[model samples]
Target: MNAEQAAFLLAHALPPEARKDCWQRKFTRAHRSDLKRLGVTDTQAERLARILPAIAYYGTHGPSLAAARTPLVILAADAHKAAAALRVVLEGRDEAMQESRGRLLQAIESLHPERCEVDPARASFFHSYDHREPEALRLLTALQDVEQAAQHAVGCMPKAQTRAVAHTYPVELIDAALSLDGPAFHVSASAESKFRRVAALCYVAAGHGEPLRAIRAYLRERNASPEN
Candidate 1:
């Protein structure tokens, strides 16, 4: 079947409520016989044959499909990376950057409600920790790591009081990562936040100055209780 025929058949298979003008545009001049051969039933085939032309005509002058898919593509890529990082933390595997691994895992787990459920496996990890100084240090280190990841994901808008410098990527991209659904959105939020914290820490460590002071001040003020 031709592209038009395939488009029509696909549209018909979708729910009636989903039959938007866009679908009609993509399926113009679709053939009934072609649709049936492609597995659409007679009833579905007939419906599509009627609506396809109008949809195609409207879409021809409407937004390009590429425009709709661009954000999706970006979000998908970001999510894949985040998921891979989360898997490492969940398995207790050594991540490339040890300091940020725990924080990364925490932020990721925070995004899901499943973490709050009483899973035996998760409980085992918490209980297994020995109450020793070394273990305590390790836990603290992990928390720090996760915090850094969260900050990076949010994207540091430079502030004056802290020395932490924000990453140079577009703020909109960070916002998109936080707001978009799917894996990339989650991953970007985690990774971006972690990266930002790391940058801030490095600047302080090198004695270059606190780059994120302004950002920290802003967060602090925002979280403060309002005056009566």
Candidate 2:
């Protein structure tokens, strides 16, 4: 489907009653539980919460995508990568010069969710040795390794502060990774208080111009310092 249609579908999927204006506002409290059932971790759930709504909106909105299994699986794979990239940024560098390349590439692979399903038919076109399930498991194992590496860094921050940083920082890293930006851009920029990188991209990809006008104002408000 075209980007405009996808954007409309995404915007429509969002519940009207939610308070936040971030990409994740599309979901309700119940939606959070839905994510857990899908095997998203407690830490990753909040980030996936932003991506799943778009997938759901498109999954049912388009005929070609809705009738097939492949698109959803592909989306599941991408969402997993985006989620993993965000998780990696949560790995504190402590003023290090750059993010690890090996780690970032692993970010894309490691996002295989624990609960992801693999049908035998979809698993292989040739033989048992070529099965997709094993490949998926290998990726999940990689993701776990990154999480373990980040654990010590996480210990350096308070719980509440980590959660706050997570809301914006991780999302930035996900966008940077996808955009193929340079290593200098890979590090998280905590000074940017707002989170328009992903949200704006979603809208732009949707080809919807209406939201851009309002989004500009919303950004200004977010960019403003609290004391001012």
Candidate 3:
């Protein structure tokens, strides 16, 4: 089998369980000839064995998985940031809240009937009671309500945010081939060349679309590159 035939075989030859496990112990030094028979060099086969799991992972999830997940990932991050900010506010004596309270108190004090002349509209209504006292009471009541709301938010916030989150999904096979970039999918230098080719073929094998002409053109460019 030539490289093209080998690529086709590699797309479907491995067992599902073995593919899922990335053919870990399944391919050993003893199976070098098996890979050689499929037109893969011993060095290339070794690299291929190492990268199979990543390829299988991409196959299982498909190319569009990352695009589908990106928006939700960003939203979750925003929520986490908002929650963290809220936690900071509720977990301590908030300086801003204290500042606001001070301002409100000063305003209420300045508006007191004793401090300043009461407005005619205010002086006429139940002239016996001071409106400042009721206003202060209402402010305190509103503060209590805010405190209760903050407590509820504290209870609702996640106890521990995951330190490591894979917000960006691994780059797909077709994408890696098209871009000639696969670091996101962990494609190592040893396996880079053949892996990109086979990965693109596998993507086509999965019935995604007729991109063979583009794939061929890309391969030609890679072959002509100084790095290749």
Candidate 4:
């Protein structure tokens, strides 16, 4: 094991668990020899241990864990530096999400002055036809309508208006709303096929293809049809 091996192990070992106490304990005891074999010095291994929890949290919450981890593995000056870089990446993600939330609020406010007020205390009312029933179904239907309208608008708009509104609330919010359920099974199947096609690209980007290929293959096979 060398630096490349160490990076590979770190990439795969990041678990989805939010609380990393068990992962940390097991990682320290079980992987010590492997880490040493990978040419990670004791000090570097300690730095990795310290950062594992944050890495795990960020991995589970972020849009693309592979994309988030790519820079750390590729660009960091050393193992310790990589750990610090991971923290910065996660912080940037948090800041971006905060900015998106602010933009969402501003967009909603701009729709007002039609003499309508949203009671923060009665936020549920917007979603609910029945006061006692939170209207998740209603919200989903509304989101679908928004997505359809946005797609049509984007298709019809002049290139300038399309580009301008690309950053606006309708496009962003509709996308966010639609993605809330994650990808559908058929879409996920398609994505897995696409992922496999791009495995080489990911490998070139990350300097290793095995982990990504393994994950993509798993997704593909998991959704594979018996007839096909």
Candidate 5:
């Protein structure tokens, strides 16, 4: 056998079970035909048979000495690299959660309070406090307060201060945040109505749209009906 083939034969020869019983042998010897195929002389074949060996009892089925041992070291190294890659991916995902948190907060603050309707009952239900502030604060408070829920929706505690965040925010991200690049509106409604729509869209994008919309809808319906 060649040097590489010889190494494989030696590396895989000994089974642990064979170690326990010396009589138990691991055979990896090339057959006469195998040596013939390799153009091995009878003397060379005899030498190969002597060194290349295997145990008697094994998995019961396998290739003859012609079989090459697995490249386990390379495989192990690859697996280790793959594991590290996954760790990096997980860390990045956590960082993204932080970024999302920061972005959502920024979005709330950026929203002009005078423009939106922050329904008091909805805000109170979410915040568990009596905040009658306009829609911007209510929405901001909602994002701030729902830490656990945000982590669940986003996958972890969210990101940095405004200045660092501002550098990160590209024009595309801003457009996406506002959906300003989405369908343009010809608003004939009040400022509150227009702002409420924007607020709802933002909250929805933050992954907590259900509760936000529910409250908004309830308040709208309530407002539409005459007070008892």
Candidate 6:
């Protein structure tokens, strides 16, 4: 089938209620399960899974990461090469980035429930993937990698603060930042009280930085964005 036809079929295949509840709300493994049951191809599911967090983040946070530009630039200047990499994605609207973000948003829009499907009780709930599932195991592995990378990023932080800092932000955000793809720009300055903490950590973990110097810059930028 053609693109429009594929989109329509996908939309129609989804439970009326799941379409409604997930539109601008939280997405979970359970939602991913729904997509699979509806026969969404592995290719489609993986593509969607990779960027859904970014989509959800931007939906809740804001449309753009404009405020983070200066912080990212400063972090880059401080020898955080990863920051520079992420900044490039944010600043430039390359074809790949545009197409990826566009496709994700379109898919989400198609899944949005119609007015009649708004009631939660109408949607059947299913168990999300547990540790036993291959998908869950794969995700577990990826998260383990992210945690290890985050440790390097925050390695310079004090013994007392490191754990808290690492635990606060979602791993999905860090993964997005490091990928140097669509979600890289989805990291928002306003989303976290200590956005720079996670941002700097992602940068350092991704590579390049005098940790002490980078932390200083992150703290300095924290107050500059009053909205955060």
lDDT of 1 by residue, 117-180 (tens): 4444445645663222233344455655555555454344332233323322212222222222
**Error at 64, model 3, angstroms:** 4.1
Off by over 4 Å in 2: 1-197, 204-210, 223-225
**Separate clash counts for every candidate:** 35, 2, 0, 0, 13, 2
Q: What's the CA error at residue 193 for candidate 5, in Å?
A: 81
> For model 6, how does the per-residue alpha-carbon lDDT over 48-150 read when each residue is reduced to its tens digit?
4443333333223322333434444444344445444433433448898666545543444455423123344433558442122233233345544554555
Error of 1 at 67 (Å): 1.8
lDDT tens per residue, model 2, 92-211: 465441345334434444564333445556566575532333544555666555544444444443433221111232232223323332221222223331223333333333332223
Provide the TM-score for each candidate, comma-separated: 0.22, 0.18, 0.25, 0.21, 0.16, 0.17
Instruction: Give candidate 5 misplaced runs (Cα > 4 Å).
Output: 1-5, 8-12, 19-38, 42-44, 51-55, 59-228
Between candidates 3 and 6, which one is better according to TM-score? Answer: 3
Q: Which runs in model 1 stand beyond 4 Å of their true positions?
A: 1-60, 88-92, 95-99, 105-114, 117-228
TM-score of 1: 0.22
Evaluated at residue 153, the lDDT of candidate 5 is: 40
User: Which is superior by lDDT, 2 or 5?
Assistant: 2
- Specify the highest-TM-score model's number: 3
* Angstrom error at residue 108, model 3: 27
By TM-score, the better pick of 1 and 5 is 1
Greater-lDDT candidate between 2 and 6: 2
Candidate 2 lowest-lDDT run of ten: 161-170
Residue range 16-102, candidate 3, lDDT tens digits: 664543323334454455445434554554445544454444334333544544555555555556555544433346788656545
List the global CA lDDT of all models: 0.39, 0.39, 0.44, 0.37, 0.35, 0.38
- Model 6 — which ten-residue stretch has the worst lDDT? 161-170
lDDT value for model 4:
0.37
In candidate 3, stretches whose alpha carbon ends up further than 4 angstroms from where it belongs are 1-36, 39-44, 57-218, 223-228
